[model samples]
Target: MTGFDTFLVADWSAAQGVRRAGKDAIWIALAQDGAVKPARHFSTRLDAEAWIAETIRAEIAAGRRVMAAFDFPFGYPTGVVEIICGAADPLALWDWLAARITDDARGRNNRFAVAEEINALFPGEGPFWGKHNRDAYPGIPYGGRSRTAEVSEKRACDISAKASSSVWQLAFPPTVGGQALMGMPMLSRLRRIQGCAVWPFEAWQEAQAVLTEIWPGLIEPAVRASDDLRDRAQVEGLARALSRLPLAELERMMDIDAPEEGWILGAGHGERLTDLARPNSLRPPPLRNDCFALPAGVDWTPVDTALALLRERLHPVTGTTKSGLFEAEGRILAEDVIARRANPPHPNTAVDGYGFAAASVGEGDAVLPLVQGRAAAGAPFEGPVPRGSALRVLTGADLPAGVDTVVLDEDCSVGDGRVAFRGGVKPGANTRKAGEDAGEGDRVLSAGRKLTAPDLALAAAVGHGTLPIREKLRVAVLSTGDELTEPGDVPGAGGIFDANRPMLLSTLARWGHVPVDLGRIPDDRSAVAAAFDRAGRDADVLLTSGGASAGDEDHVSALLREAGAMQEWRIALKPGRPLALGLWNDIPVFGLPGNPVAAFVCTLIFARPALTVLAGGNWAEPQGFEIPAAFEKRKKPGRREYLRARMRDGCAEVFPSEGSGRVSSLSWGEGLVEIEDGERHIRPGDPVRFIPYGSFGL
Candidate 1:
């Protein structure tokens, strides 16, 4: 028998809360009849599972056999299944997880709690490890074990796939424990769909829709293309490759399946699969480890120098995905969108009046006979408007073959079977030439551009229905301080409501980033450490507001220096002098000042443009204009300063207070008036740089 007619590959995620198309989120790519379709994204497992089931049924209804593959492992190590379910069956283990895992529609789930419960069933820390909150899950361990007398860390297939992380390792890169825990339930639901059969466990030829586990990493080298999202490329590449494999080869790869612990398809046949697939060269490069590293002995950096370093070091850390034109607004382009056809598509009239060869009009006022029929918009006159004869045309009408010039209706007199116009109505006047706006194959939108509504309109006019755009960067926001409490919660005396996290999160959303809330972390060493680990796993970057300074309670910077790569930047800027740049487990972290106003300014001045570059766009320079200052003050030479200000009658007005501690100043002003470095006595009429809030994409 031949192989299945369709292949569907799903990259699963364990992230909580609904998410957009982003790195580490679920992506489903399909290949039908040897053609790979654009991958689809799902924010929650319920949605992904529902879509997968419907797609399988539709394909089967169409009489095409389907093969569905999931990236997570189908089962745990051999003995663990028997210990958890009292049976040597992977399907039984799926049922156990499905029954206990409380995954809501929003993707909030009790997977960690379930892991802890499962650990209680076994002695000396059960198989699952690496919970985000170690204190909350005492039953679960924080690290993996080599082996136990009864259980093994890895199954036999992991060695075949050369996978680095075991099923027991969670919370770290390359780990499969969380994926399997969160995914198995969805897999179980998919297996119950009509005409579905589990691979290796069921007869393949007899099943109309086969569901199996896949390891996209097995062919990672072949799909590691530049400028594309890794998850997107992997699914697209693997689906296309696997759908081409012969049934005999597929069966041979499945020859040594552990029925209790399901085998990854093509686990032992990596060379064969890799050879059949061509590498995809369309993905963004993974973020480099040294992107944030600075040369030794560099300290007390200037604002301009710090920004320059960020621009030089940063690259697009997000992946690319195809979005329909309407959905592409605010998204950065992944690749240049070329025009499929020219704008106007044909020589057309720009005004409603006379159209005739410019040669017929002699450089003087003239009159000409009219053509038999008028061309208005979509309608065109039949024959060429014989050289000397004028054709009456309306706006947007295609010009007759012999016509080259037109006169505006208001500038001409048309009646009595003739049209007359004033002199100096130059050749090609009021006419739109073919391809005037954009020609076929021309780059209408360049890569790294953030798409706007006008851009969408232009793309649609040029025949582009969809655009390739970078996935939104997931930025985790955290706040640290013992004296702060959530806004809605009551604080007895010293506690104040946390503002930085919410403000940062809102700004991130406005700037087209997916904001991940890591919640508040008190000034505790271990708590900060746990939050950092979680941030690494959950977000592309972490933005922390407090505990960035070197005070004893400044655990954020201290831990980063101790455990990960860090660069303490004593930036030469007033109100926001202390800044922390670091990498926590390879994820970039930006630590801003504790003062609300300073954090707001730093995020705009530093993080704003840096994030734009990281999100696959050009280095963003917020638009600023020079306007006369309404207030005067003396300046210092050592650092640049920004005063919360607003425009009043076309002049800049500084706020009453310049203190970074004045949280009210942020809301009191419309924008910031920038004071350049160097001592200066500002006058009321002095030209000052004014940056509106809108310029920062706020």
Candidate 2:
């Protein structure tokens, strides 16, 4: 006899006595030699439980191990109300009430609580014969008086008791009646088996899918009725347990001998579990100190000329190498990529149909005999179908030899091993000829092009494993202020919180430069000088947000002169007019205005493109689109102005307040509309060019 392990699920419905079918259905699944068969269903709980117990006992008697899961709650919450009231046992009080309730005992004086007590002792037998009114059952203190209430309480107790007694490894709450009571015991058992309770069904399904992908063969084959519940709970428990277990023990459980190999075991699933990972910043180049103050009344270079100069100076530096596929997103290619081989290496079937020699088919009544062989994926036809012959092929199958045309299966008739095509078939009909996508050794991607997913796929198809990529530039960020405290800390009366660090980090990421935060530097010139020295030693570019202006306390400009050489200072711009550009040990340094909005604007206009140049990419300035102004605004004539403005209905609307010191204006504005050197008072409906936030390294 072949012994099999089987699980049975039984469903039951309330006994309404009108030939009612059970709402609950039980499933009996077979597990033979560690493999589970498709489950069979049963409509009755009694039948399911009986079969399960019988099978378990028989398996044990035959010296075979068997595990079963029962759908029920096992433990009862003994009624403290009755116990504390000094009533004998609650069950005794229950029985005394059961004897008094009769089917005809309804009316004003009917004692219903007594009936409820009786039903609690014997679930599934309900509709007590007692009355509806009473505070407590007669002669029983605190006993439920309503028949309905008593019966409900009794069923809860019964379900709980049944769940506690089931010795199965796992318990599933019943699908229907008494679910509330059954749920508690099942949850309790789950907590004991695995520290955490089961998640909701939807989340459980997702967790199970993830586990199956990562731990291919670890889980048993049987899809337990509660497999989703068990798998999710167990996986979470395993994660917690594994964290506590020694690395060696965890590796043993994962069936790995070394830690490196074990780490890779769950790599696929781990990637899906977390968000995208970013690479660490590369060390910056050294700087040279040769501070030279800006010449007074000097004519500043145009944006285009300045960018061209910066590009020439910075483009020679190279970036770090990364995997071609992983580096595809947000990375520009260093050189043009030519195809080493043509796409679709050979002529293949474009449709799942017949492949016939085009020359063999005549204009009228020409029938070609079908070859016995069929072509499918991975199986190409060995030889050409000779003249007057056809071969059957599926989609993606290689075209048969000497066949230049394919007649879709719908356009052909087959009989007696011969296929006849409909009229009007052309020589190259349905044929995807060679080199249709690209010729052999053709240039696929051009130099300086940003690599997208499609580009990565194309590169892989060409048999290239690694690609030459320009490295990411390192930009050092320093926030300077003696009156600033870190976020989440209590600040003194004169102190403000640090916001520039996070803001600069996000901005640098957008601009494709890796930002190395040097935290907050103090107001002292020595401390500032030390910061510049450190930045010069490691950073390709240094960005500071304060102490750029000429003031007694402002030290960044003075420190830059002391630490290295000054390049350009004091751009003729509003809000960020005090901006300073220099070099510290040969690394470029940008000292932006201390105001939050001004600092942000300065990074967008200057620092961002400078980093792009250092990263070996083009330094194209953000383009502006012309739009009408919603309101009139006044500006100085000689200086270039950037007003915080937003676009709506193709019109640029300046944010209400335009003060350089007002940080709140930044929050209200989307970007700035540059009013070049000649413009002064602009009226509503006037055409103005505005640059969007996204285009300006935001």
All candidates: TM-score: 0.62, 0.54
TM value for model 1:
0.62
Mind giving the per-residue lDDT tens digits that candidate 2 earns over 24-61?
Answer: 33344444442334444434433443454565556556
Tens digits of per-residue lDDT, candidate 1, 327-400, equal 67888998988999999799999877879999877878889998888998878788888989988888999988
Candidate 1 global lDDT: 0.83
Go through the candidates in order and give the C-alpha RMSD of each one to the true structure: 19.1, 20.2
lDDT of prediction 2: 0.54
